[model samples]
Target chain A: MDLNLTILGCHSATPRANAFPTSQYLEINNRHFLIDCGEGTQRQMRKYKIGFSKINHIFISHLHGDHFFGLIGLISTFGILNREKPLHIYGPKGIKEVTILQLKLSKSWTKYDIIFHELSSKESEVIFEDEKVTVKTIPLDHRVYTNGFLFTEKPKLKKLHIEKIKQYDEIEKCDYNNLKSGKDFKLSSGEIIPNNQLTLEPDTPKSFAFCSDTSYKPDIVPIIKDVDVLYHEATFLKDREDLCEKTKHSTAEQAASIADQANAGKLIIGHYSSRYKDIAEFKKEAETVFSNVELAEAGKRYSINSYPIEILN
Target chain B: MDLNLTILGCHSATPRANAFPTSQYLEINNRHFLIDCGEGTQRQMRKYKIGFSKINHIFISHLHGDHFFGLIGLISTFGILNREKPLHIYGPKGIKEVTILQLKLSKSWTKYDIIFHELSSKESEVIFEDEKVTVKTIPLDHRVYTNGFLFTEKPKLKKLHIEKIKQYDEIEKCDYNNLKSGKDFKLSSGEIIPNNQLTLEPDTPKSFAFCSDTSYKPDIVPIIKDVDVLYHEATFLKDREDLCEKTKHSTAEQAASIADQANAGKLIIGHYSSRYKDIAEFKKEAETVFSNVELAEAGKRYSINSYPIEILN
Candidate 1:
C-alpha cells in the first residue's frame, strides 16, 4: 500500500496564468481522495494524469471560493461522464445547500448518489473510517468556519515469518491466520510459540495532515502531532506578516513553527501568495526554522513513507 | 468604436486539458461585457490580455454550472484585487440567491457593489442598456430556463466629413458636434448644409447574437435576424442527432440552419462536445448549410465589422 499526495494547485486568493488556487489529490491505502478542489481542478487533474473515476471521496476545508469553487464543476463533469458510483463529500455545513442549488437551477440531477457529510463541529472528530484508512477533522482557526483533514492508515496485520511457521507442521494455513493476528501458536506436543517469535510486526501506520488557509494558531499542533507528512499553508512571507495577520493567513515562518512544534516527519509548504515573484524566499524562510521543508509544486507527488528523503520540489 | 468578440472558452460539458467550457468577452463600442463565464474564465481573460477592470457588465445565459461557475470566482478575485467600481451581473432569476448564499457563507463581502439583474420573463426584453450598447434577451429552448443575449451597439453618431467641414470657415469646432449628431449645419450667411452632405453615416450599428445550449428552434431567427455575427451552440455532430434531441442540444447542421434562416452576416459555431476528437467535422457539417461559417477556437478574436473575412480559424 502506498500513501502519496499530489499537488493540483497551491496558490492563494486568486488563480493566475501559471499558478492555481488550492487543490490536492491524496492516495492512501489504495483509496483516492480529493482535497480542497479549487477552480480549474479538473483541468489540473487531467494535466497530472489523475483519472477522475478513481476519486470516490472529496474533502473540502471551507466555503471560500478558491477552496471549493471547482466542486460544482467537478460534480457536473461527473454527471456528464455518467458516473454511477456514489461519491462522498465531507465539508463544513453550507456545502450541501450550495451544491444542491446549483444542480437544481441547472436541472442537472446527477445519476450517482452524492452523500454529503456536513460538519460544523469545533472539536476534532473522526469523519470517515473504513477497513484501510480513518479520516478525522482538525478544527482550524480562520476568518470563516474551517477544518483541516487528517488521514491515517489503519494499523496493518502482523506479517507471518514463513521460515519459522513452516518448522511447525502442526500450524496449518488456518492457524497461520491466528498467528498473523498477533496470537501465540499452540502445538499439539504441548509446546507454546510466542507471537513475536512466529511473526514480525508490520510497518507502522502512515499519517498525513493537510492544514490550510488558517491563522498561526498552535492549538492544532496536538491534533496533527507526529504525522508522517504535514502540508501547511504558507500564504505570505515574513515581509508581508502584517497582511498575513490581517487576513488570518500564515507566513512561511509560522508554517515552519507549526511543523516543528508538531514534530512532523516531513513538512511541505504551499498556498503561495501571488505578490511574491520569487518562491525561493519561502524555502529559505521555512528552512531557517525547519530542516526537512519541501516546497509544494503543482503536479508533484510526495510519498509519506519516504520521509527525510525528498521526492520532488 | 470597435465591436470585437474574444473567445475565452468554447468546449461544452466538461473542461479538458486544452479545451475549456463556454466563456466569451465582447467589446462593443468601447464597453466591455463578459458573456457566459465558465470555469477558468479569469485565467482565459488573462491569457488573452483582457483587463479585469475593463469588464463592468456580465451576462449569464442560464444557471448551468459551466456558464456561471466562473462568475463567483471572478467576483472573489475582484474583491481580492480591491476593485472599487460596482460590477453588474444580469442572469436568470435564481442567480442572485446562488451567488449571495456563497458569499454569505464565505463571509467575503466584496468592497465593490455587485448588482444582479435577474430575468425571468419569456418575452424578449432589454435587460441592459448604456450609452453605447443595448442588450436584449432571446428566450431559448433548453432543458432548463435559458436565454441567449443579443448585444447590439447603439446607433453611432455620424462621422464628420473633415474635408467638407473644413471648406466652411464659419463651422467652429463646437458646431461640428451638432453636425455629427445628424443636425444640418446652419451658416451665418443663412446657408444650410444638409446632414448627409456634411457627414457620412457611422458604420452600421453592429449586432452580435449569442445562442448557446439551446435546441434547434427557428423562432429565434426573427429576433437575431440579419445580425452582423451569430455564435450558436453546436454541441453535437449529425451522428449524434438523436442525443441532441434527447438532451435539447443542437447539432452543427441545426446551428447552421438557424444562421441561414436568420440571414446572418457570419456564423461561428461552438460549445463542442467532448466526445468529438476532431473539430473539423463540425466545420464541414455546418458549411454544407451556411457558407460563411467558422469554428470557435479558444483565445480567438472575431471582429463583427469584418464579416466574410475570417480573422482566425
Candidate 2:
C-alpha cells in the first residue's frame, strides 16, 4: 500500500506574498482526498499538478475563512469543467448553508451531484470507509467547532511463503487463496497444515493523523497514539505562548509535545504564522521533543512508508 | 487628474494555467476602486503590487461566480489585516445576503465597517458619488440580473495661468483662488478680465465604462457615450456566434460594434473564452470595426489620458 501526502498551503491566517493558508492533498491506497481548502487552493492545486477530477472527497475541518474560503471557487470550476462524477464534502455544521447560499446567489448549479455529510459529533466517529481504508474524526478544542481527520489503512492479507508451501506436495496451487486468507490447508494424506507454517505475517497497517487549528489538548493524544505520521498545527513560536493560548492555537513546542505524548513514528508541523519569516525555526523547535520532525512546505510530498521527498523549487 | 486602469484577470468562465477570471483595478483622481473581483483577485493584485489599503470601494457587476467569488476571501483578508477604514461594496440585490451569511457562519467579522449598497434597478442610476468622481449602474441584458458600472470623473478645476496672472498686480494671491474657480476678475480701472483669458480650460472629465457577461445591447451606448475608455466582454469568436447567443455572451464583433456606436475614445476587449488560445484574434476581429482597440491582458495597465502602455513580461 502506498500512502502519499502533499502539502498545498501552510500559512496561518491569510495568504501573503510567498505564504498561503492551510490546505493539503492526501493519497492513501490509490484514493485521493483534499483536506482544508484555503483561499487560493485551486491555483495551488494547478501549480502542484494535482488533477481536479481525482479529488472526489473533500474534508473541511472548520468554517474559518482561511480553511475553506476557496471551496466555492473550486466547486464553480468543477461545474465549468463539466464534471459528471458526484462530489462528496464532509464538514462541520453550517457549511452546507454557507455553500448553498453562494451557489443559489450565483445561480451556477453543478450538473453533478454534491453530497454533503454534515458532522456535529463531539466524540470521535468514523466519517468515511472503504475496503482499503477508513477515515475517522478527531474532535478538538478550538474557538469554534472543529474536527481533525485520521486515515488508517486496513489490514493486509498474509504473505505466502513460497519455499514452505513448496515443501508440501499435497498443497495444490488452488489452495494458495485459502492459505493467503489465513486458513489452514488440508493435505491429501488427511493431515492439517498450519497456516502460520505456510505463510509469513503481513506488514502492519499504516495510519496518518491530521490535526490543525486546535489548542494543545492531551486528550487527543490517545486517539492518534502510535500513528505512523502525524501532522499538527504549530501556529506560533514558544515566545508567543500567551498569544497562542488566547487565539486557541498551539506553538511549535506544544505541537512537538503532543507528538511526543502520542508516540508517533514521525511528526510534520505546519500552519506557521505569517509573522515568522524563517520556517526552519519551526523544525528546530519541534525537534527538541520529537526526533523525527519535518516542516510541511507547499508542493512537497511526504510518504508514510518512505522518507520525505522534496520537490525542486 | 489621472485615470489609470489595470487588468488583474481577464478570462471568462474558469481560471486556467495562463488565464484568470474577470478583475480590474481603476484609479481615478487618486481614488482607487476594484471592479469585478473574480477568484484569485487578491493574489493577482499582489502580483501587480496593488496596495490593499488603497481600495476603499469594490463594485460587483452581477452574482456570477466568476465575478464575485473572490469578494468573500478579500473581505476576510481585510479583517485579518486589521483594516480600520470603512470598506464599501456595491452590487445587485442578494449579494449582501450571500456575503453576510458566510461571514456569520465563520464568525469572522471585519473590524472595519463594511457598508453594502445593494442595487436592484432596471434603469441607470447613480450608485456612488463623491467630490472627485461619480459611479452609476448601466442596466445590461444577461441570463441573470446584471448591471455594468460607469465611472466618471467630476469636472476638474481650471488651471491658473501664472504668467498672465502676474501681469496684473491688482490680482492678489488670495484672489487667484476665485479665478481658478472660473470667476472673472475686475481691476481698479473698471477693466474686467474674462476667466478663459486668465486660466486655461480644465481637462475634460474622463470616463470609463465596464460591460461584461452580457449580450450585445446597444441601449447602454447612450449611457456611456463618448467615454474615454470602454471595456467590453468578448467571450466568443465570430464562428461561435450561436454559442454566444445561447449563453448570453458577446462576440468580438458585437463588442466592437457597441464601442463604435458609442463613439468611445478607446475600446478594450476582455473576458476571452478558454477555448481560444490565441488572444490576438480578438484584437484582430475588433479592429475590423473599430480602429482604436486593445486586448486586456493580465498585469497590463491602460492610461485614459495617454495611449496604452505595454508592460514587459
Maximum-lDDT candidate? 1
Q: How many backbone clashes does every candidate have? A: 0, 0
State the lDDT of candidate 1 residue by residue for B81-128, as single tens digits.
999999999999899999999899899999999999999999999998
lDDT of 1 by residue, A73-177 (tens): 999999998899999999999999999999998889999999999999999999999998999998988899899999999998899999988988888988877
The complex in candidate 1 yields a DockQ of 0.85
Docking class of 2: medium
Going through the candidates in order, the fraction of native interface contacts each one reproduces equals 0.90, 0.59
- The reply for model 2, stretches above 4 Å from the true place, is A162-176, A307-313, B307-313
Q: What are the C-alpha RMSDs, in order, of all predicted structures? A: 1.6, 2.0
Model 2 per-residue lDDT tens digits across residues B1-313: 3888999999997766567789999999888999999987887888899999999999999999889888998999888888999999999899888888888888888889999999999999999999999999999988889999999999989999998999998988899789878999998999999998899988778899999889989999999999888999999999999998899999999999999999998889999998888999999999999998899999998876654533333
Which parts of model 1 are misplaced by more than 4 Å?
A307-313, B310-313
For model 2 chain A, the run of ten residues with the poorest summed lDDT:
A304-313
Interface Cα RMSD for all candidates?
0.7, 1.4
lDDT of each candidate versus the true structure: 0.91, 0.90
Q: Give the TM-score of each candidate.
A: 0.97, 0.96
**How big a share of the true inter-chain contacts is recovered in candidate 2?**
0.59
